[model samples]
Target: MKIKTLIVDDEPHAIEIIETYVGNFPEIELVATCNSAIEAFQILQKDRIDLLFLDIKMPGLLGTELVRTLKNPPKVIFTTAYQDYALEGFDLNAVDYLLKPIPFNRFLKAMEKVFDGYRPINRQIVSVQTDQNKSENFIYLRVDRKTVKINVRDIYWLESLKDYIKVVLADRTLVSKQKISVLAELLPESLFLRIHRSFIVAVDKIDSYHSYAIEILGKELPIGRNYKDACRQRLQN
Candidate 1:
């Protein structure tokens, strides 16, 4: 069964990001995108939406206010730039509160909640398909205002630069305006290892390693204290 979904946000770019993420899930059927709470309210009265991706702050009517007005509101995942609205969002029984520039990994976590709570019958099938295909061999990343596809096997290592991540490949490096933690989530766990807060290395690309650091392409990257145990376990097996 398809999960009828609606996205309500004033920002066109924000809506676009959500739309792209939603497209990955075959079970979700996006009903519409609304630019305002008033516009969304109109659609809610007529449609049978199972899930809502709602932006908290709007021009006039707030997303929370619109939810309150509904006699039986659909499962909501609140999206906002401000962190202040988190408490209020939870009070309204939101499935999740997403910050702006939502990471695909974070969005996946929120969607897991929706799937678990709303549809247990299709859980096994969804999980199997999602695990099989989600970022199987390549991933699309925004670089220089365009989406670039990077082969997963081409990656040697990744370096985090605050708000940006440097993707090091066999022949070249591509800098993307995304968190390394977010990019890590997109890669296959069997092929990658997060050795430090600022670094993630391709497991197969490692030339050598010790208790302290990992050697990749003749460069030594320190293993974070918190990640040492997991790193050791992953490399050993």
Candidate 2:
């Protein structure tokens, strides 16, 4: 079943961009675009929406406020120009938070997380068919409006910045709006380990380590207390 989606934003151009991006994914169907929270609330009363693209700074009855009143809110991806609301958005268990002028790649990555959340319930339908077709040496990442190819071996580590992750390579870094947990699943388990809640270090990238931190690429990353035992065992190998 396609995910029923709603785009709630005051800007016509913003709604248009999201409508265009939603078309790229076959699993999502655009239901409606409301210019205000009041209109969106009315639509919600009559429609069953699975995903929501919300703008937090709407004039009255703010997007955040609208979600606060919903007993069972749909998975939300906040698209706005302001960055301050990111922490609050995640506190509401939002699927993703995006900053504007939203890039298509970021939009795609956010949809990926939304799809990942529904994967268990709709496993057969939501699972990426490319997983079966692709080889182990490389992976596809939604980076800047295109699904860019990356060699897994070139990745030094992954740093999580709340709603996004930085893929550190030897020469450059690629940032994508993907959760750390989601990105971790894409990486080969044997070669990667979550040393901290916000960090994933390549097994071969470790230069040295103590009980407190693991050194990678001349930088020391703290080992989360909960992840200490696992990090110790994995890095020692």
Candidate 3:
């Protein structure tokens, strides 16, 4: 799917470079270009901008402020020369942050984030599929044709095997040959979250979290290198 995007940066050369790079991707279509956040905001009000390539430093307003001002902002990817704003970017759930003087490969990664901005493709988009036919809170585990019904609440944590996942519960671990990404959606969002590419854990099930791992039922699970901050914040709350 083509992503309609906007570029908002103070530097004319920076905007030119971005426009040139964005032209390289078949999936990306530049919708608007603005030198300031206010101009971008006006454009956003009139156009359907799907993604934003925002710059941190600008004359009247900072890029982060522009994002905060929007009631329903599009997906944002902060573009800046300084690496200091990385924490702020993630706090806003930015798709990805692009360092200034963006190389083609790095730009490619940012473009790929279009996939990440939304839900993982396999899981159905949440909707009002309610009432008599409410979505079941259980997933069927293929246990040799005798499918076992596993309640989402019972899942404490899951570890990735070479070809499957070991669903760790208080009682016992059940084996699931499902991708962690897909299984993530099957569970309740408030209860479970993907702390790593390989691990999924119940938010409420966490007993104590440390700098390295979270201790659950005396079992410690390694926090994925990049996902530590998000997990720590969530666990603390």
Number of the top lDDT candidate: 1
Q: Model 3, range 1-237, lDDT digits (tens) per residue?
A: 567999999997788667655654445678889999999999999999998999988999999999999999999989999899899988998988988666544565666666665544442211222232233455545444334556667778987886677888789878855555545545666777677788888888888888778878988888898888888787777
Question: Least accurate stretch of 10 residues (summed lDDT) in model 3?
Answer: 124-133
What does candidate 1's lDDT look like per residue over 147-192, in tens digits?
A: 5667789999999999888999999999977777667656888899
Best by TM-score: 1
2 against 3, candidate with superior TM-score: 2
Clashing pairs in 3: none
Give the higher-lDDT candidate: 2 or 3.
2
Candidate 1 segments whose C-alpha is farther than 4 A from its true place: 123-237
The local distance difference test score of model 2 is 0.81
Summed backbone clashes in each candidate are: 0, 0, 0
lDDT values of the candidates? 0.85, 0.81, 0.75
Model 3 residue 58 CA deviation (Å) reads: 0.2
RMSD (Å) of each candidate, 1 decimal: 10.2, 12.6, 14.7
lDDT of 2 at 191: 82
